[model samples]
Target: MKLDVNALGTFYRMAREGAGLAAGRLTHMTEVETQVGVTKLNFMRGREIRRDFEDATEKVAVRVKLTGAIEGYSMVVFERENALRVVETLLADSDSETDIDVDAGEFDEMTQSAVTEVGHIMNSGFIDGWADVLETVIDVSTPEFVEGVTAEPFFGEVDETPDEDDLALLFQSSIETVGTEIGFSHYLFPKRESMAALLDRLRTSGGIEYDKLDGFDRMAERGAEEVAKTATTLTGIDTSVEIRRLNFVSLEAIPEQVADETLVGVAFEFDGMPSGYLLFLFDEESAHEIVDAMVPMEVDEDGFGEMGTSAIKELGNIMASGFLDGWANVLDTTIDHSTPEFIHDMGAAAVDPVIIQLGENQEFAFVFDTVVMADGREFDCEVYAIPDENDLERALNNLDVDRIEETPTTAEFQELENS
Candidate 1:
């Protein structure tokens, strides 16, 4: 199932720009420097996606049903603390008390109304962007606030969570102000097989340029250079990085691309403004050769022994860290990574866990594949950058790109002032 990478990128851009609008509206209403940015967007299986909210245990969400051309539901879910912060910020200038205790999950009538209004504006921002791109109008129902971790109201009446195979388009956005930041993931559950029509609408609307992620290409290129230099220094093996493929892809497409080939994959989880996974994949032979080069003395079996795995893990950690350090420098944000996990398995299986884990929050994954060469010999290895959608949106917003027009019209600005 090879999806159109261009339309997906356009959709990503649309969501990002839409979030920018939503953030502007929030700032207008709160009179705070609110920054709204898309953090994640993906089309994932319904049951797998629910794991995110289920693990949440408890949270606050504002939900609304969509009607007209598109039939589905839209929601803005916030962490308990951030929801409280939102309430405090919205009511700051009012005569009411401006303090919000972290433990206070319940909001007063005025506060609830204010939050619901924010949700309405955000929902409009997102749908309006979709309408403009697809050239269609979609109406939204009134926003309703609910507090629960199971997401009972959002899913409607069901004796138990349905595990049927249904697609969910999940979009997450983060609302940030000075000294206050909160993230909310929005999910849209349309009828089964609705995506084919949606994608067709997007494609027929226009041919989207597939390389819009050129921003990330530049970022990854710079980061790869850094990783190559660091690897050369650490392993004392002449090394270089050749970026092979860079594009946005969906979860289902990953296994197809990787196929049944076996490889040694070192995985790292990066957590930051836009969190994602970085995988260093190498052929078994290359893994062994690289391990041999890293270790001064190697006389064990040909395959990757305990010592070989540890050496490769260290090399991967160093290279991955160096690479993300470059990204952090370019994006001007902090990014922390998890310990590298080493796996020697089939290519599809190597990435399955990552896809499933990320699937909990998103449907698409950004893949930045690069080949690491040693001493002019092709290592037959790849590096993948599977970043969170919301974080990628934020990171992309930080970069200068040909984004959709985000400024409000004169009448709209006037309306904002009055509101």
Candidate 2:
């Protein structure tokens, strides 16, 4: 069972199309405007996945077992409040004289029934989209409802508590109702062999070994961890990686997904076997906080003026080295990055140059999507690492999967002279 960029791109498109259909169905049923949000494939360890679901906020998920073309589980998860809001809309359309208090924690038979219907329709739309792409039929089972403040309800259904090394293939699709502002997560989990067969059928190029996927996961995990460590060491803020995902998307879709308002960003172009651009973006407030944390004394600067910009660029330079070093160690190759390029403008404007440079060569990119944040502080940073398609394919092909696990991730930190 091997995988390639083309196969993964097809999977991404299939999921996106399904998400749109699901949104359409929701609009028709609830009579509320709806839309599909970010759709990406997530490769996470069992430990990371468990940590993600334990946010202390109650959640409701509709789980269905799949057989036929796809074999595994499909889950639709919603926050407790969002589920209540959606149920309210479904109940409003019914000819019932009774009004249930959703906030009172009373989900009776009728509410459960409505949620089930929503879950069923959503699953069908998603599976139908995939079927249309693969030209196969997938059978879905009865929907089962699970709700809890902890991860027990969901984890209990799974075979067992998976260890950290166990990798899970999770496809995430978010759907939001415009009027109610309700958001829900849809996940598709297919069996290993089934996924391998699907990939084999969809793959166009000579796919890399399936085991090589492990190298991709390790590099991303190590890079994200190093960036967080570098940020904390430089700014003295205890920052940590929140979410890290490998996304394949079009160059045109890149700018559209970024924040619309002005952002403080640090951009870099790295030259290596898989040469490409890397960017670290932060909100205006977060940038200010980092500047303040680095410079003890408050300067009388309006926006990020000379002193502030310098601080950001220096941080970016060191962080860039650390990030690339992680990859260099993984691939057993040297990756040199250019000097940090400071960007203070709208988010779309920051990425326009990179898009233009890469747009001529390829349509899609393998983007490392990561978020680093600190608890109880404004230290949020979004990291995007886009690699060249041909070069990346070449690098991945040369990767020695056996050595990745034993190789240590070390950041080459250099001292910056203060002017």
Error of 2 at 393 (Å): 3.3
lDDT of 2: 0.77
Global lDDT of each candidate = 0.68, 0.77
Which runs in model 2 stand beyond 4 Å of their true positions?
44-57, 93-98, 148-169, 293-302, 375-377, 407-419
Write model 1 residue lDDT over 1-419, tens digit each, in one string.
Answer: 11244557667767776787787777777777878866445545565456656775567777777766567676777766677777776656543564545465467676667667777888888877776766778888778888777745556542223244465666756777777666777767765435556656545223322223445545666677778888788777787667643445567666656636788979999999778888888888788777877788855755777888898899899988888987776666778999999998898888888889888977767776666677665465677778876677667666544431221111100000000
What would the TM-score be for candidate 2 when compared with the true structure?
Answer: 0.86
Instruction: Let me know the TM-score candidate 1 reaches against the reference structure.
Output: 0.52
What is candidate 2's CA lDDT for residue 260? 89
Task: Give the per-residue lDDT digits (tens) of candidate 2, residues 1-419.
Answer: 67777887777777777777877887787776777654456655565556657878788888888788877777888878877787776556553654646867667876777777887888887887778877889888888988887777876766534445444555555555545445666766667777777878888988777667667766776787789889999999998784355667767778877888899999999999779999999999999999998887878899999999999999988888888888887888988999998999999999989988998988788787778889899987888889888888888889997797686644221111101
Question: How does candidate 1 score on lDDT?
Answer: 0.68
